[model samples]
Target: MRLPKDPTPIRTIEVVPYDPAWPAQFEAIAAPIRAKLSPLALGVEHVGSTSVPGLTAKPIIDLDVVISSRLQLPEVVSKLTELGYVHEGNLGIPGREAFMWPDGNGRHHLYVCSVNTPNLHYHLLFRDYLRQHPDKALEYGQLKEKLAKQYPGDMDGYSEGKQDLISRLMQEAEALSGFALHQP
Candidate 1:
């Protein structure tokens, strides 16, 4: 698979104070996605680290839009491209598709998937879990900062570092929110 142009190789992760701008930024991006995909989309949600307030992130927003089928991918890609997104295959993660918005600021990571796709929902559930629970969010933030430091320049390594923590947190979220969790 071709690597994404802007690889976020780790450097010290810092859970900076919550930026109130995140929600508005998400809405701005979501509006276009919703409009373009409405006929094909089941729902659109803000996922990933940026979606959680008081959480430090890689400064890139992550959005997920649930569509009906894998066959619908081409259309989704075309539509998103028309709106300035550059398609990027999941590279390694299957059952999920990714895209990068060509914003000079390097703003977002967008994904499209099926409604029945558990991984998509799991990401949303995790985001919601962190949002609703401040302590956990803080803990995750610290973990990220540490992982960033340890895995600097290693994007794959950085992601692997968080796998265990994410798994355990997903369990807590499932129990507390009753959202079904998908093991990736």
Candidate 2:
């Protein structure tokens, strides 16, 4: 039998009710990366639905390793690679670089982003908004659940379905945050 070369290919879009352990899971994934990178990584953030209490989401954890500038990327990538994660370039998002573990390091989406990146801002904005607004989180969770069921095994469709709600929520979040976040 042949196996796919990509180690952590997300083949399906499975959204489930929030698990309380998600924060600990993010820590498990973050700790070592933090230890190794230390001063190089400004912060290893827990972003996406799993970061918000009671928000339904895919089991995957999303983390952003922040750096001061793209100048830090080479060392960041090297250190992460040493930790067994393969650098997957930007994966189309310019300011963020993606990395994936080769084994069962638990499912996660890891990105290295400079402090000024639009991608990083969006991730933080979305997570913070959901964390503070339970009502909005509930709405997002319901939408995600419906989309997950409607687009089983269809990641593209599931992601596409989230655009409208996410955009609206981001706008509200930016406005309430007293700043405007541009979409990338």
Candidate 3:
């Protein structure tokens, strides 16, 4: 199930070998948000497959900027908007707030969420787990590659299909941190 030869004008997806510069790229992008929303921003982290060293990804850096509460969203969104970010709302994930990163190349996802929420914590736990366990990261990479081929243009399908595998890995992640799931 290879991806279509010709895709839409949006260029919603692309395949690329992991680059060493992704972390720095995330840091560069997170800096301004960190400065402007320091009061609300608890911690900014680099997550997603690209953050791992040897994975193939869509060449997009994914970040999570932790805040204090959902009510703080408007002010944070305003700050991000001032920096040219396009607020995309949840895009389906109810507890998570996603943004369309403004570089025009569709190469980053700047997700905003509060520390009071579990979404960001889960992402961080999973990422950290994969970072500490390279074997798990490899397994996840293979699963992702297979899924991307299976549901090339269907983001929702691809994401949903990977839920089981993700959950299993996340269980391991949570155990590693001794962090039980907190209802969001």
TM agreement with the true structure for every prediction? 0.82, 0.92, 0.83
Instruction: Order candidates by TM-score, high to low.
Output: 2, 3, 1
| Candidate 2 residue runs with Cα over 4 Å from true position | 1-10
Clashing pairs in 3: none
Candidate 1: clashing pairs of residues: none
lDDT at 129, model 2: 88
Against the true structure, candidate 2 reaches a TM-score of: 0.92
lDDT digits (tens) for residues 35-104 of candidate 3: 9888888888888988888776778889888888888899999998988889999988877888885766
The best-first sequence of candidates by lDDT reads 2, 1, 3
List where candidate 3 sits over 4 angstroms from the true fold: 1-13, 102-104, 182-184
lDDT of 1 by residue, 1-184 (tens): 9867766543554445568898898899899899988798887888888889899788777888899898888999899888888888975777788887686445677888777777787887898889899999998888888878887777777889898998889899998887666544
Global lDDT scores for all candidate models: 0.82, 0.91, 0.81
For model 1, the local distance difference test gives: 0.82
